[model samples]
Target: MSILINIEDLLSGSIVEGTRMEFKKGWNPVPIMRSICAFANDFENEGSGYIIVGVDEVDGKPIRPFEGFNPTNLERVEKELVGYCNLIQPSYFPRLSLEAVDGKHVLVIWCPAGANRPYKVPDDVTAKHKSYNYRIRFRSNSIIPNDEQTTELIQLTAKIPFDDRVNTFASVTDLSKSLMREHLQETNSKLYEESEEMPLEELAEKMNLSQGAKEHLFPKNVGLLMFSRKSQEYFKGAVIELVEFPNGLENPYTEKQFEGTIQKQLIDVLAYIKTNVIKTKVIKYTDREKSDRFFNYPYDAIEEAIANAVFHRNYELQDPIEIRILPEAIEIISYNGADPSLKQTDFDKGRVRARRYRNRRIGEFLKELRLTEGRGTGIPTIVKSLADNGSPVPIFDANEPERLHFIVEIPIHPKFIEQGNNQVSDQVSDQVSDQVISIIKYCSSPKSRQEILNFLGLKNHSMNFKRNVQPLIEGGYIDYTIKENLKDRNQKYVATDFGKSVLIKIE
Candidate 1:
């Protein structure tokens, strides 16, 4: 945020504090200091926050026609704020500037994020101040969190990723050397040229799967996912539960749990989707010599959706990733939700989905395995692939309070039910007789009885129209607009899906 807020802009009533902006009536040391502390200790990755003094707020909205800070108190307030910082345990120096709106002024303090994090708010400005109270901004308010919330904030402030933490109960031997070696070779990186010769602990450290201990190394969560032969032993929710519902309800026709190293699990799940979930069909148009091919849903799109769930899901959560295949659609639901740093409107506005991965180590490994294109390219790929395959765009729901699971719903391909039943089959040897082909190829519009006969250079619409146009209509290449009322004066023949497919093939 800049060191200035335009009075005109503020008066325009368009400014919403959202997650970062705060409005204060005056430089009340207690509340203002708390705001500064919260901004400095911000852990939800909201880069930096701004605190504006002199603008009065009620019910989270800034009211109009109110006078801002008195121009006289600006310097005095700055000095007092600077003095308060000195009395605090750790110092926080903010960039202070006086901005004028309609000749009335307000102090804008820019509290940027500092490297020395988890700053505490002093109990008072007393010389013997000793309290180490912490505060954080949640939405528009600064809150002193409860014990559990405090712990989560501390972890977020330390930047301790869930995937990198050491699983103390699991030994380094839990990691499988054979699986690590296979992954290294599959990725084919020069960094792993001597991977086979490296000790298990060293290899695990190299892949960020294990961290060295004072005596014995321990496997990290990411390491367990990659090299551990029994990852499910520690992480009970690590498995992906795949279920196919025949009636689209709780009754499962087939249920399977894929539990193993994540890489292996992803491969197994993808193979299962291709074999069981996806249905391929051969389509022939009219009496064409060749046919067309498509599937119930694009396999590449499915891979993107499933990979996104596994790679970015919050593995610390107790729930497993779910792949539910129903008659109408395939849904991939991941445990936990999206980045809390962003607002729901941000996702609705088509903002960038990922600025940081929930599991950076796992995501990096997937990228190395060519399972994903990192740097926030996965969602766009899924969208484009679905659209190109003539399917509706996939729906993604993140941070829904009720469900609290990231869901990707891909509708079943339209052709899934209508495949072989399509009017034209690929293998029809005489789908359209030669005489009928001559009639359809020459007409742009739907030709009537006499019009078709004239185009075929026949004298009458009697038997000539029957021999030529009748075959085209009955063979499924063409159809009359009013089939039941063919005797109507406006009745005319038009090409069907079978005919259009054939026309393109012949071209």
Candidate 2:
């Protein structure tokens, strides 16, 4: 495998320490080996991570670049680190290279993602290694999963959705009767008034909180999420972690983690985003536009995306569904990908619907709560609402794009969204050919691929549109008004901020 990071950037002090990259002042045999193990078994990470021994990390930023390794002893360090990699229980071998950063000698260890995952430190290696055996990288640190976390990870081998399975460790008493009664009232069923008087055991069973009958029973993940006071106790990462990074990616302007009932978490997260992250823009009233009030994104779109994350995310993976708010966009990230037998491109246009659900039981419950349609309307609702609000096309970015992780990124609105936007950077204009620019300019408003062809006084050439217009869409210079409805005959394209930049460049 190739080296995980750019040597030039590291020398220039551009890359720093984080989940995927780490820098050290000097080679410490034990800690360096532990980090290597963590990087190898990076289940939640996108790609493999890199370790640079030479730079000092301060305040979460790499600084004070130094000669990382002793040049005369560099070969010896390599031999020792390689030995450590071999000593890992599952065995992790990294690409060891001796390179120079700013004339300072440094050793770069490129740790590849583990082929045999969930690697552990060998018991015979050392007591330090044994004590901190199976390690996973969280942020920048190699963390030991506590007893509950270990149990949680092991229990996921059944490959069932957490909400669908019975919680073997939790008993019927763990689920609160009051929470069940409140849930019944929220449903507004004819059974609502009667549910208060109903025995707790029957109520629990009715909610599918347990298996079997009166005597033998246990709480399910869904029951804990909805009924338990500390649902996060069992479902560790079920919380919604909201962080607004106004200053930069590394700096958080505000941060909050919401936990409780699944539905409550959803509601509170939506409220928090609307109150804090949602920005209102005032436009000078014009003859063309009457409304003065314009929000950064549609409220409904935000709600749909968050609700979908809660209902659809793999709760077996111990990572909170993270909502990151920034000036440019709002990113709602869920752990793991959806099941698709097809190739990555099959879901690229966002049309592939899984034949079954990863969370069927939880989905059904959300439907009863009126939180979601449970008809796969989650994505459609998010896409339509954003488009209606004059936002850029919503994107579902995934690390394994073909695997289908649900990551809804809703870009904050630029001015004049429906007609497209105000001018953007000319970076894309320089990237495209003259033929593409003309088609974009001709689209004063939204235009179809065929309409543009007619405007250009050319007969239909399917390949020509694909070659010219398709690139524009991919470059983020232009977008379809109805991205989810790409098959629609009336589907039209409009220039984005970046697209407008291309037009201004042409002018």
Candidate 3:
């Protein structure tokens, strides 16, 4: 089976971290088995790791002029690997691929987090007298877990992350071949080439997106979320709902819902926000060569906040990820907050880190799609983005104690806040001067245009109407009673709920 990631990216250490990858000059059965076992343990919940044989290493990185494996021994090595893997207590087998790097063959082992974990293997696979122990990856080395760590590992028995667990309700057909191909193509994976000809089950197996016995295959939760367009059917509230409260929640508001593959929804929602909400302002300075340029709310901060919400949210919840654009801040809310290990104090001090990710497989797909940087970078990225834009410090609330919900409230830039205040002041000033407030008050009960003109002591000319009542209608202070027939002789205007709120403010 082909590895889901680009082989070149793996070799260069561009996408995968050093701790998750190891380079071996040649295969030595015992050490390879230990590394494989450690990777299967996945001590940090950082997802599966890779082992590259036939590459010399120095300081934990691949060395150039690799000592490639002898191609003639490929069959014998495969047989040996299978034999050693059988020594694992639960009979775990990692995916292996053979590729040529710089005119020489190398063995790539993809050891995903095992289903039945806390796997143990004999110290020496060839020994008749064997000692078995559980091994885990620590940074770059495989080590036997201490008693405390061993107990923790044991607790994770048969406890695959929610995203990685096979969905008994979903079949392999639920995963879209097109979506899988698109993702493979986007990541530049070689799997994309073979995807067209491969059956759905085979392709899913190659991507590690399915599990169970060969006869009764089921798609994993991550697979459905990433590939199925109708993800909400399976995972309730697998959508984003964006609400804009331009005039406060008490008044009229606009809303939009984004649904699709999680990555697609993320992209669409971000684009919608950028075009509709994000505003750039320039302040010229006499003392400096460059003008001050910043956004109302930095795009980076918003992007990371929203992406993190999707990555960490509980898919089982009925609450959609929500983005509320209020006058002073944008609140990104999701259900079932941070991991239990993270305290409220951690969120308060911006030291948010996950001991175990709620959705490891989702995070992996997002990282591959370049939608997020996994491994606890989301909070810091947001903080830096806000700081750079001179926006107010973001509020991170993990709904302490129970952590029933998570909220990231990013304040609007101070300049934008000031500008909003000034605009309100200007609007009030304009209304007072134009005598439109009186017109609105007069129209509390729907009144004809003639009655309004007579009340305002204004002429009935088009310019007079445009200057007086038209502004009120356009400002949302009043609406036409006969809105569908604007030119109807019986058309009348009445105060809107928003207009009543405005009167409360100004009165």
Q: Which numbered prediction scores highest in lDDT against the true structure?
A: 3
The alpha-carbon lDDT assigned to residue 427 of candidate 1 equals 31
Candidate number that wins on lDDT, 1 or 2: 1
What clash pairs does model 1 have? 176-227, 209-223, 284-425, 284-426
Candidate 3 lDDT trough over 10 residues, lowest sum: 422-431
Task: Give all TM-scores, in the order shown.
Answer: 0.53, 0.49, 0.81
List the candidate numbers ranked by lDDT, top first.
Answer: 3, 1, 2
Q: How far is each candidate from the true structure, as Cα RMSD in Å? A: 20.6, 21.4, 14.3
**Candidate 3 residue lDDT tens string, 297-327:** 8888999999999998888788899999998
Report residue 29 deviation for candidate 3 (angstroms). 1.7
Q: How many residue pairs clash in model 3?
A: 0
**Residue-wise lDDT of candidate 2 within 324-343, one digit each (tens)?**
88767888988776555423
The most accurate candidate by TM-score is 3
Which sections of candidate 2 miss by over 4 Å? Answer: 1-160, 286-289, 341-347, 401-406, 416-507
Report the lDDT of model 3 for residue 442: 86
